[model samples]
Target: MSKKNPKTLTVERAPDQTSEQATAEVAVNPAMNAAFVVDTYQSNILGDDVDTDALVATLRASMDKSAAGDLSGLESMLIGQATALQTIFVSLAKRAHHQQYQRHLEAFLGLALKAQAQSRATIQAVIDLKFPRQATFVKQANIAHGPQQVNNGHANGGDTVRALENQTEQIEVLEGATHGGKEMDTRATAEAARGNPAVEALATGHRPKKRGR
Candidate 1:
């Protein structure tokens, strides 16, 4: 039998086609696109209607029997409940103790700050009341002692004033003497420049030579 010519299937791609086109296509389904959901189940362990008093009595009886070595069937359950209750009470006690400690710490810090502020205010008040009085006393003492100590002398007021006047007159005399000496020197220099024989003789202690006829 003659084999039929193999059929060739040709796919036409655009010039911009790339190797990424060879990747497999992904299928999207509505079910896969749905959001995640969780279902929670809850049930009451003891019963739908619980009688707390009866439960306590039952647990007490079981504990009594277990203590007496009677091995009641509910002894393990009562022990488990008691352990859970003890853990919860211990946690509550720790929280209460921590809260009390925090309150005490905050109270102590507040008292310390208040005491510091009060002490600073008291010190400032004392300084303000005393400093000006001390300064005024010092200034008065200086003024009271100034006149008696002026000349280091025990003389009376009249003698002290006369002594100060004499010292002032001596200072003025020395200043005048210095000025007179400077004026005399300047006059001598001028006379020398004018060729005065008397000034030259006075300066050298010798007579000038007579000019030739």
Candidate 2:
């Protein structure tokens, strides 16, 4: 029997082909193609002329929006977690009741209590997420350190006019009283002088001599 030498098959590659290109060319399956596709996309994104800051900002914005969406849906997730914790608590409670030893019973009960507390906390978290507490912004009031005089505007000078009128009326009344007293004194002197000369002389500021009775 003659032993035949096995022929080694040589593969031809392009002069410009890289190791990655060779690997991509050899890959036939979609999974292998997917990896290379991702690599090609990343390479395209990280090109020399690419605006790195803009790219990073865009990626950050996308991620931030996704995170915000997750937060928006967090209420349902927290409620589910609370429900699951309640189920665990119930299971633990049943196990605690069936335990024969005091230590096992205490251990299971403690675990059940912990689960119950966690469930309560999850529920509260959901409530807090859904109905967030309102922020109270207190406005700064500029208060004077000492006494401040506040002037509410005057009422159209009505008070000033009333005060002036009151002063005028007081002056007129004083003048009238003086004149009326002078007139009364003059009338009294005229009537007394008509009846007696001596009384008239005394009223006129002259000295009167005593006359024979």
Candidate 3:
């Protein structure tokens, strides 16, 4: 017989495909296991036509046994919590954007108040760098004390009036600044231009010849 051609030979073979997958079992605590009824596989929640009293009694008895010795059985309190948690409504926590939430807080006011309170520590940072000693602050008034009451009790007129007038002038100058200060003198350029060389010479009448330097 002639040798069979390898390409012409036919054979039946099973089709290639992956097998069906199964989920692996995860071990959970016994307390959680109490949520499932062993025989019916129904969830033991509040709406069920029920066994709460039995579950509670079972929990109490189990906890009493486990708490002292068994250590693996469901505790009464934890069972109640886990069961109760099934019906609980959990609200999502809202996250405030970092800087926006504190936009209206008085942090700057707090800082300024702290600065005022700790005025002694408000010495210049430059001063701190150079001297090892802590600063002892001395306050100087921008406003001098009003005239002392003598036995005569009169403010000296000349000094007081001069100060008042000076203050009024300063206030007026400040007010003027808001409207824009007075324009600069443009007179010098005009004066120089108008007094041409001929006019200047005429005004001098004639120039004397200079003597030897």
Candidate 4:
């Protein structure tokens, strides 16, 4: 009977090569290290006898199919899942009805509700996949132009400009009414002032000229 030593399995480093150089060589190719890790992982899943190249090719094909937007298989799978959930929901509801304890009934009923919700979600997923919601993209233009003013009350091609001018004039009249003349000239300065002497003199400020009845 021969006894095996673990030290015999270890490879002795060359006398000329330093540890730092050996470590640098080992870490030289990151891509090769990643490939090595992937190989080991796939070997664990598919066994050492499986061809990793063929498996990788198949995975690439599946990815290409998805990238090409061929989703018939995915849609079928979702529909099948929805059907399965519906069956589960019915089964749970029946079980809930047959339960003697109130707590058990409630528990089963809650599970049935969850299954029902999952079924609805699956169906909605299919609907969304088939007839996708149309996305409205509002394009904003950063144009160097005049200022924009929005008049929600007025319709297009109406008297919007005219109405605005009228409003401005009315505002000016209202302001003038609210605040009386800045300066009143009742001095009868020139020919025009002398002609309307009575009109220029305010009744409040100047008493009516003594009229000999």
Candidate closest to the true structure, highest TM-score: 4
What shift in Å separates residue 34 of candidate 2 from its native position after superposition?
21
| Span of ten consecutive residues with least summed lDDT in model 3 | 89-98
TM-score of each: 0.21, 0.37, 0.17, 0.45
lDDT of 4 by residue, 1-213 (tens): 785441221222578988777666546544334444666787767666544444444555655676799877678879999999999999999999999999999999999999999999999999999899999976454422234343554457357566556667777766554327564445646544657677574656566677798
Candidate 2: tens digits of C-alpha lDDT, residues 53-99: 34444444545755776564456668899999999999999999999
Judge candidate 1 at residue 206 and give its lDDT: 61
Residue runs of model 1 more than 4 Å from their true location after superposition: 1-114, 120-155, 177-186, 189-213
For model 1, how big is the CA root-mean-square deviation? 34.3
- Give the alpha carbon lDDT tens digit for every residue of 1-213 in model 1: 984332211223456765345221111222111211100111145332333333334555656776786753444444455455445545544455555577765655555555445545555544553443544422221122223334333447688677667767777776665554653343443435456655453544465888999
Comparing 1 and 4 on TM-score, the stronger one: 4
How well does candidate 3 score on lDDT at residue 200?
42
Write down the lDDT that model 2 would get: 0.65
**Clash number for every model?**
0, 0, 0, 0
Clashing pairs for predicted structure model 1, backbone only: none
lDDT of model 4, residue 155: 54
After best superposition, candidate 1 residue 16: deviation in angstroms?
99
